[model samples]
Target: MTAWGVVRTAFGDHDVPSTLMGVTVLGYDGQLVEIEATAAVLDS
Candidate 1:
């Protein structure tokens, strides 16, 4: 969780999955886990 703390998109920058740390993700490709905030993105 670096690079200015989670704020990258537009097909660039994003890594942390590390084999899906915790659980309850619903959808995810790869490299971007770092748990704590599931519940559908903290209730949106």
Candidate 2:
């Protein structure tokens, strides 16, 4: 998933969250893909 990779990379740079820490819930809204990162995004 290139899109997911990009998001992961960007988040990694911003210290937001990576796949290791966050749970990505991908949802389809019509023709667009919506990504929702939960609380796991925050390293605790």
Candidate 3:
């Protein structure tokens, strides 16, 4: 599975940078799963 998301703070600052993430589930067992993620920041 794969997913994407954005993280934001509640400070209400327009200039606040944006954090974007991409995640993927590479492998899974009955009780464990491996995950990989990458993140980037964009200036606002």
Q: What's the TM-score of every candidate structure?
A: 0.15, 0.26, 0.27
Q: Model 3 over residues 1-44: C-alpha lDDT tens digits?
A: 22222222333444444444454653555556455667566798
Q: What lDDT score belongs to each candidate, Candidate 1 first?
A: 0.45, 0.59, 0.45
Per-residue alpha-carbon lDDT of candidate 1 for residues 1-44, written as tens digits (9 for 90 to 100): 75434444422553434333446664757746444554223353
Query: 15 in model 1: Cα distance from truth in Å?
Result: 34
Please, what are the lDDT tens digits per residue for candidate 2 over residues 1-44?
A: 77678777766756553554443653554455457856634466
Instruction: Rank by TM-score, highest first.
Output: 3, 2, 1
Q: What residue runs in model 2 are displaced by over 4 Å at the alpha carbon?
A: 13-44
Quality of model 1 by C-alpha lDDT = 0.45
Best by lDDT: 2
Cα miss at 22, model 1 (Å)?
4.6
TM-score of 3: 0.27
Ordered from best to worst lDDT, the candidate numbers read 2, 3, 1
Candidate 2 local distance difference test against the native: 0.59
